[model samples]
Target: MQTYPTGVAAKATGTPLTTLQRYLQRSHITLQPCDVPSRGCGENRGYSQRRIIQIALTTELARLGIGPSRAAKAAFEFSDKGNTGRPVGELYPLGQTLLVGLPDGKSVVINIPPDKSISDVLSNDSAAFICDCGYVVAKVLSNLSKS
Candidate 1:
């Protein structure tokens, strides 16, 4: 598992460096290795593959008008602990149209069966943000490969 610095991670995740920095500063994004003085601050400021996925998720959240802090927290939770019984990272590179319900400024990812249609997923939601996990991961993986 290769680790990328902030710049490379931002590029890989399709997030602007400044935006990523802001997320980090706001504690929306927490460095995996933990950027602490004991571990050589600069040396530990790295993002792993999972982190890239988390960042990409944040980008998708932002597209849905989610604020930086909320988006970061939601993305990190979805990517790290998952929302649909599994981490969103597990769906990486797969063409899964994740139906993320956005109600009252809350981000909740609903589990949609493979046989279900978008209409089925949105049957009860007031607002939904579909995250094309495949597309997002493709962009990130493509950018990462370029490194």
Candidate 2:
């Protein structure tokens, strides 16, 4: 797996460094220790390609006026829901509502809006909001793994 330093990751994701650091602090996003040998007591950590993609997605979510708390959860959920071994960017154009695939092969459809919270969308009992993205992200990720 390719790893990126914080600076490089911030640049790659087009996120401000401080915002990225805040995301790292608030989210359960996985990170790895830098593989390079260090001479000092403190060793540098690195972000994997996975983490970089997550940051990029989170940045996009933030651009939609979503705060870090929800954005973090969304990022994690998107990653989990789209997991098929492909790059995370393959999951773009997430429909208004996302149908998350569960581990048991079942799915949970989540309705989302810029003005409403995710919890609020879930609590709304309207069938009109229920729809799937056709698992397009998942398929893209799967194809990426095959290649």
Candidate 3:
């Protein structure tokens, strides 16, 4: 498998170099092979395809208003669960909502209610975010099966 250096990985994942550096430093999560080395360190950093995907996921989490630390954690957790070297398709983005399938063969769409806007949800302290996308796991499994 080809490995991408820091600049290339950042471009591939649509993540800022500084933000990627921060995650590499603060998050103890081990990306597959070759992650950014510590600041001022001379070690060369590389990113596997899997690590780039993880960075993409982390960027999405950041867009969803998740803090960098938490985003890094969630992205790594998702990566760990899949444990595949395959890259996720570029077509998918973390949309406003998701349709998830349950273990019981049930599917549900999670999103803000029709009456609520993102601003409304953000402004209201009583409002909460909801996400129920188990199909994401299914997709990951499907991709791994192809390998």
Candidate 4:
């Protein structure tokens, strides 16, 4: 498995290094370590690509109002809900995108269709505000589609 240094993960995920480190220290995530030699000539710790992606995804989700803890739990639930073998991308239009910023000083652009029902688009445990956004958007789209 590929691993990413703290900096690389921070850049890729649009998260600040300090925040990432705090999350790591809090045991909010498990990261894969890199194999590169330590630049400080001391103990080196690295993070895995999987962990980086998870962090990035979680961060992005939180920006959409899903708290970290709840986001983690929802991820597992969503994965299981999709066990019917249908890809999520296939279920929703891929081109619809949204730009979001997290409280942790991270920003990301994600693709999420305007057509998906609010209930289908967000995790059950998602923040109430997140569901509200989906509901508001869905209503707007429904009106537009009827025209």
The clash count of every prediction, one per candidate, is 0, 0, 0, 3
Tell me how far the alpha carbon of residue 131 in candidate 2 is from the true structure, in angstroms, after superposition: 14
RMSD of each: 3.2, 9.6, 10.5, 11.6
Which tens-of-lDDT digit does each residue in 109-143 have in candidate 3? 33444566645644433322223233344443354
Q: Which residue pairs collide in model 1, if any?
A: none
Most TM-score-accurate candidate: 1
Give one digit per residue, the lDDT tens place, for model 4 in 35-126: 34346876566655435445665565667766676553343222222323334212223434332333444432333555665346443424
TM-score of each: 0.76, 0.51, 0.50, 0.47
Write candidate 2's Cα lDDT for 39-98 as tens digits.
466766666655665566567656756565655555555544454433333443343546
What lDDT score belongs to each candidate, Candidate 1 first?
A: 0.68, 0.52, 0.51, 0.46
Cα-lDDT of candidate 2: 0.52
lDDT of 4 at 18: 84
| Ten residues in sequence with the least summed lDDT for candidate 4 | 127-136
Ten contiguous residues minimizing lDDT sum, candidate 3: 83-92
Off by over 4 Å in 2: 28-42, 80-147
| Candidate 1 residue lDDT tens string, 1-147 | 567777788878878888888887888878765332225754646677878888888877797787767777666655666543555456622235363647665665455667767677678677645565666767888999999
Query: Candidate 2: which pairs clash?
Result: none
After superposing candidate 1 on the true structure, give the runs of residues whose Cα lies further than 4 Å from its correct spot.
33-44, 83-88, 92-95, 111-114
